[model samples]
Target: MRGIAIRIHREFQLMDCASALSIEGLVLEMVGAATRRRAQGLSVRPSRWIREVKDFLDEHFKEQINLSTLAKCADRHPAYLSQVFRRCYGSTIGDYVRQLRLDYASKKITHSTESIADIATAAGFYDQSHFAHAFKIHTGVTPAEFRAATRKK
Candidate 1:
């Protein structure tokens, strides 16, 4: 018989009860997680960890964010978090953040005397160019152009 060895990292652990099962049964048992994950359609409602994930995104949109770190907080995988967050919120987290930034920029431009650069900074954009691009995409004009047009009309 051919033999192989597997090594597991101490930091990452999985629980398995397949030791007593026959080879075929062990294989079936190992496939159960995958089968159930697909059968149930990974769309869990946003409860528990998902709510915390949403709150974190709302608070931290101005900073660099990583899916791995956010998912770690929820005790879930990034792909899984992305999937269910989208399923529950009707949009991806990225989209939600972008919308937030644009909405905030719109409100700031409409109500505050802050320069576009300052508004962009406050909205979490790296620079005015990046902010302008996103703002134009969201509002159909460059920030200055938008301000001029709004003021004229």
Candidate 2:
């Protein structure tokens, strides 16, 4: 579990989204195993922790988040925190963060005259290229293309 957390954290810091997502899948598998074990005994409800983490993410999605910091805040191990979050929320933390960033960028694209690079930076992307790649993947269009298409509608 620690190893998985470490790998995911490393990939995330390097901005390797694909690697982070792949490692998160491993975390989900561990979560499934842990769930089965807990089902065999007394299962403690993690509703409060889940809610706290979700709220925190919702508020700070634009910030550079560290799993260790979040785990410490929630008083849980990083792996356990991620496992519980994925199990309950149906998405990895990285995916949720990216979705938040993309959602913000998309809104700015459609509603404002800000340049794509400016919007990307404001949305917490490391670079315009990375933002464009993610935006294309999410919406099937580059940021400029998306803007043009939306403007024509």
Best by lDDT: 2
lDDT of 2 by residue, 53-128 (tens): 9889988887889899999999999999888887666567888888888878878998999999999999989999
Could you give candidate 1's per-residue lDDT for residues 1-153 as a string of tens digits?
Answer: 000001111001122353233344444543664455456664456687788888888888877777898888889999999988876665677877877787678668767789999999999888999999988765445888766654553
Q: What is the Cα-based TM-score of model 2?
A: 0.70
| Candidate 1 ranges with C-alpha deviation above 4 Å | 1-45
Could you tell me every candidate's TM-score relative to the true structure?
A: 0.65, 0.70
Weakest lDDT window of 10 consecutive positions for candidate 2: 1-10
Candidate whose TM-score is highest: 2
